[model samples]
Target: MSDIIVFGIDFTSAPSARKPIRVAAGVRQGAVTRLNGLMALPSLDAFSDWLAQPGPWVAGFDLPFGLPRELVEHLGWPTDYAALMAHYAALSRAEIRDLFAAFCDARPAGGKFAHRACDGPAGASPSMKWVNPPVAWMLHAGVPRLIAAGVHLASLLPGDESRVALEAYPGLLARELIARRSYKSDTKAAQTPERLIARKDIVDALEQGRTRLGLRLKLSHAQRDELVADASGDSLDAVLAMLQAAWAASRPRYGWPDAVDPLEGWIASA
Candidate 1:
């Protein structure tokens, strides 16, 4: 059996004890991926420690790994992926907001944000957006930790070969099963019956192997209940990400395409 554990991370830029980063852990055997556990990282330090653990694992992290190549060029940031990450990590959130806002101000209306190549196909937000999902902050928070932990980011950077991290987005997979249907929401008021039904539909589809990835999600009875009960959707997103990681593990280059821009790293299964 392969010793590689698969992990899916639902990341938060500023994790607290109340709103910690959520992770779904699992392992694959043949065509089925069995979810093993869920984790809540109380802080960035805990997340860092988890990544630094000694193991051979492939992780699908729900965080943007790179900015749009066009944005980087326009801002005169280093073209080198590693260097750009270094420069980015050094800035405060306020600085990032100011810089990005300035960039947007210069652009024409209706297209304020620069996007990575994979964004169009994945139907994802631009990595530069700081509000709503705050993916930009997620990138700021997550990438540096991956770098410090020495995890190889497929085409983006080579680090700890055993601990390979790929950019994963749960929406990319969820959309495949349920087109634009809202599933889970963080707010209690927004967790409608329709969203609950959507979550169940998504779970059912996964169990039926209804995705292009062709991997069945195996869950215990208790696990299924736990997944359906979480109105926040964090746990479900992690599982979705784990499925992506499992799929990537089965293919070469961690399932990254040949044309993926190294500077603008591609999302796994995008």
Candidate 2:
């Protein structure tokens, strides 16, 4: 059997005191084993510590690593990976807000930012965009750590096959199965019993490997209950993202390739 550890990462937009990063792990033996607990790391440093643990592992992180090539060219930001990370990290939220605001201010109300071609295909939020989801900053906050961790980015085409990283969008998988139904809810107030049931329904389907994608989730009963209990879905979301990562890891060709085109994106469907 291949030794594999999968990490599912649920990313944050503006990581505040309330919402930190949530990560879940799934170990694969002859079968998949969903670990008992999830890890909630407070800061990037803590996350780095977790990543540095001794092991060959694959991670599915739910954040954009690259922006649209068009957006980068228009902004005239450094295209090199190292330079881009530095440039992005140096800017504060306020600065990012101002820049995006200016861009929006200049454009007509209908079209604020120029979206990449991949955006339609991938159903991805614009990497240069800064509003609603603030995915650009999610990339800003999330990607640097992956780079620092030295994991093999699917897009980078790195030679090291042990430490694999893939760009996973859990919503894509969720929408495929559930369609328009709301299966997972992150809002505290919206987390009613009905939503909890929905989460369970989704989990049951995943365990049974009922989707078009032929992957089964091996989870313990206790783990399932815990996943459904957490209204925030920090753990469940991470697991979903991790599963996507695992799916990507299994396939070399589909792994996010290093390319510039924000328009090329994927999204979850109902």
Candidate 3:
């Protein structure tokens, strides 16, 4: 497992200079995963290019790889996973928002957002949600590019085995350490000392091998400082994702669940 590049991507539905797609690149050697560096892809094109790169690399992307199976069934879309993605990729974002909003409107308040099987375990937002976290848009914006880039979408759409893409939620690991203390804010006004402390706690936990992933995060002092300093938490989220990738790569089945629902891709190590 040593020297295989592991990438963690904190993706954005709309990438730009202000909020570029953040990537944390590293490699796993035994139980310690070392941070190589970080980079930002400012456009979808750049992200696409990144995906097409030659790999013996495995990645955990902070985006939904599939929509809810219930939602797909309700819409009478393709039941097959690959076909469902294609049908989904053809729709406009506005079309998606409208459909999802209508679905919510017809359902009871508590039962509005239909979820994938992995959502509850991962503590992830619904893949069909178009507001707040807007992960539906993420699925739209990110997954198609992964498809066109010809990378394997582990369990959902197979491509290059060496270039694997796994769904990952940083919150899954963060909550393990900090218990839902908010550690990031896109708004500077909301980036409080409390959040900074929370970020530090997360970093410490990863460095100390406190999480259930069982792999320690190896960071230079400067790298540790860099992860903590970014109040937006994008960098740390990317690293957290990388940790998930590292955990998967260290194990059999790429750390995915046994018999994953093709319509609802599993989050690595969830």
TM-score of each model, paired residue for residue: 0.97, 0.84, 0.98
Worst 10 residues of 2 by lDDT: 261-270
User: Total backbone clashes of model 2?
Assistant: 18
In model 3, the worst 10-residue window by lDDT is 250-259
In model 1, the runs with Cα more than 4 Å from the true position are 1-3
Q: Please, what are the lDDT tens digits per residue for candidate 1 over residues 52-146?
A: 88768899999999999999999899999899999999999999999999999999999999999999988889999999979999999999999
Better of 2 and 3 by TM-score: 3
Q: Model 2 Cα displacement at 90 (Å)?
A: 2.2
lDDT of 1: 0.91
- Per residue, candidate 2 scores C-alpha lDDT tens digits across 1-270 of 574677888888556557778888877544454553577777777777776665577777777766665555667888765676678788887887787677768889878776755566556667777766678888777777777777666544353457776676776676666765676565767888877777787788889887655668888788888888887767777888877766665554544444533333332211
Cα shift from native, residue 176, model 2 (Å): 0.9
- Rank by TM-score (best first): 3, 1, 2
TM-score of 3: 0.98
